[model samples]
Target: WLKPFWLKGTSSSQRPGNLYSRPLPPAAMKTLHQEESIKVPKGIKVTIKAKHVEVTGKHGTLKRDFRHLPIELYLANSGHEVRAKMYFAKSKQLSMLRSVCS
Candidate 1:
């Protein structure tokens, strides 16, 4: 069986930098929380912010950063599936988080 395309890193550069990086800082968490306040479609919403990514839906919100992470978004409802979209700036690999939302 083939795994989802999003599960695989889009680019080699996106791989983790280090194995022991700490969790997201308080400031990043605040930004993530604020980002999650925005409305989304009926399905679970997953937003990739500048410093982190926020997942919001019926179950609630969970935030995480790319420092030490995996490329997976698990939604509570089986009917609801995750959609991964990437927005880039000048270079394809570099993207602005806010732009991806809109």
Candidate 2:
């Protein structure tokens, strides 16, 4: 009936609203951008001359393709509060690659 269809559509729209109810804190994004300006860690080197940022560390150098989205990288020795953000379509594969490259 019309009631069921209306309920379905309402539920669908509400789902995303609920998921995004709490957005990323502005302070966190600001900190990330500020951190990006600093030099890479002593053991880690980052080159952002090209479209993608190239990171070289103990493991090796890895190039992350950032043709469409912005990328942010955060490196820390410990703690969950320490992290970075980048734009890469938010894919698990990209996260894995960045972590390894860092």
lDDT of 2 by residue, 24-88 (tens): 56642222222222435567766554346577789988887655535554544432222444443
- Per-candidate TM equals 0.26, 0.31
- Which candidate number would show the highest TM-score if scored against the true structure? 2
CA lDDT, candidate 1, residue 50: 50
Q: Candidates' lDDT values, in order?
A: 0.44, 0.49
Tens digit of lDDT per residue, candidate 1, span 5-31? 764754444545533344655542112
Residue 85: error of model 1 in Å? 12
Pairs of colliding residues, candidate 2: 70-87, 72-86
